[model samples]
Target: AYVITSRCAGFKDGACREVCPCDCIYDAGEQFVINPDDCIDCGACVTACPVEAIFADIDLPAEHSAALHFNRAFFES
Candidate 1:
């Protein structure tokens, strides 16, 4: 699954949501989050992000690692 990171918090370009083939992305108040369970891991959202905020869970940047958890929590809650 792809995690939407801090860069998207206020910038919410929403391009990712449009390109997501599986419709796994959602607005989480401040930013968009990808539904880990629904994401197909096809990498479509990554390229559509204007801020480059989307990253695969395994490839998440060190500082953005927490985004992987944040993404899941949004759905869980």
Candidate 2:
């Protein structure tokens, strides 16, 4: 699972969607979200995000960043 963090927690410009290989990204109101099932973990959307908000579950460096996993799950469920 991956997440868009505070670094990329602003407007949902969808640059990530443009580069997503699996089309897993979803527009979640004010931000963008990734569907856990659809995401291939290709990491393509990470670089496409202008704010660098995207991160893999194991790569999050901060405690708050952990929320991305749940966020993705919630969006998918």
Candidate 3:
């Protein structure tokens, strides 16, 4: 599943929302969520997040500083 990471927590800038071709990303009270089932893994949202909060699950940084992965996965499953 695709995941969003800490780099983009509580972000509402919505550049990602505008760019997602599949509309897989949703706005949460705390953060943005990527619906894995709907996600085409197009990586548009990744580039859209100015904070760099989006990443593939396996691509998460070693520091684990963000909730992007957890937030996306939490709703995905």
Candidate 4:
């Protein structure tokens, strides 16, 4: 899964959402979140992210690791 980081907070650009083949990205108020289960990890959203906030789970920077949890929380609820 590619998690959306805080750089997207208040931007929520639709580019990522528009290119997501699985339609797994969603507007989460403050930002957009990718649905891990539904995501095929195709990485389409990563390139479409205007703020460069998308990152694969394993590649997620430690400073932005909280986004992984936030992405999961969005779907869990």
Candidate 5:
């Protein structure tokens, strides 16, 4: 799963969603989120984000780790 960090909060560019082969990326009001269960870990969205806000779960920066949980919560709720 890839998490969208704070840098993407206002961007909502949708580039990640456009290139996602699984269609896992979705609009979550403030930012785009990736559905962990549906994501294929293809790394396409990572490169598509102009803000460089997407990060793989394991590779997520310490400051942006909360984004991972936020992403999962979006799907859970």
Candidate 6:
């Protein structure tokens, strides 16, 4: 799964949603979020984000690790 970090909060560019083959990305209130269960780990969304806000779950920065849980909760709720 790829997580959308704070950098995407105000800049929901949405390019990631457009290229996602699985259609796992969604328009959350402040930023776009990826559905971990639906994501295929294709890495397409990472390149599509103009703000470079997407990162593989394993590669996420320490401070941005919370984004992973946030993304999961988005879909769970």
Each candidate's number of clashing pairs is 0, 0, 5, 0, 0, 0
Q: Which pairs of residues collide in model 6?
A: none
lDDT tens readout by residue for model 3, 1-77: 46765555666678887998887778765667777677787788787788887777668677763554466556755
Query: Which is superior by TM-score, 1 or 3?
Result: 1
Between candidates 3 and 6, which one is better according to TM-score? 6
What are the Cα lDDT values of the candidates? 0.90, 0.73, 0.71, 0.90, 0.89, 0.90
Cα error, residue 3 of model 1, in Å, equals: 0.7
Model 5 steric clash pairs: none
* Candidate 5, 1-77: lDDT as tens digits: 77888889888888999999989988888888888999989999999999999999999999998898889899997
Decide which is better by TM-score, 1 or 2.
1
lDDT of the structure predicted as candidate 6 = 0.90
TM-score of candidate 2 relative to the true fold: 0.77
Decoy 3 TM-score against native = 0.73
Tens digit per residue, CA lDDT, model 4, 6-45: 8899888889999988899999989888888899999988
**Candidate 6: residue 37 Cα off by (Å):** 0.2
TM-score for predicted model 1 compared with the true structure:
0.95
Structure candidate 3, residue pairs in collision: 4-68, 4-69, 5-68, 6-66, 8-53
lDDT for 57 in candidate 2 is: 71
Lowest-scoring 10 consecutive residues by lDDT in candidate 6?
1-10
Alpha-carbon deviation at 68 in model 5, angstroms? 1.0
Write model 2 residue lDDT over 1-77, tens digit each, in one string.
Answer: 77766554556768989988888777766567778767788888887777777888788778656567656656645
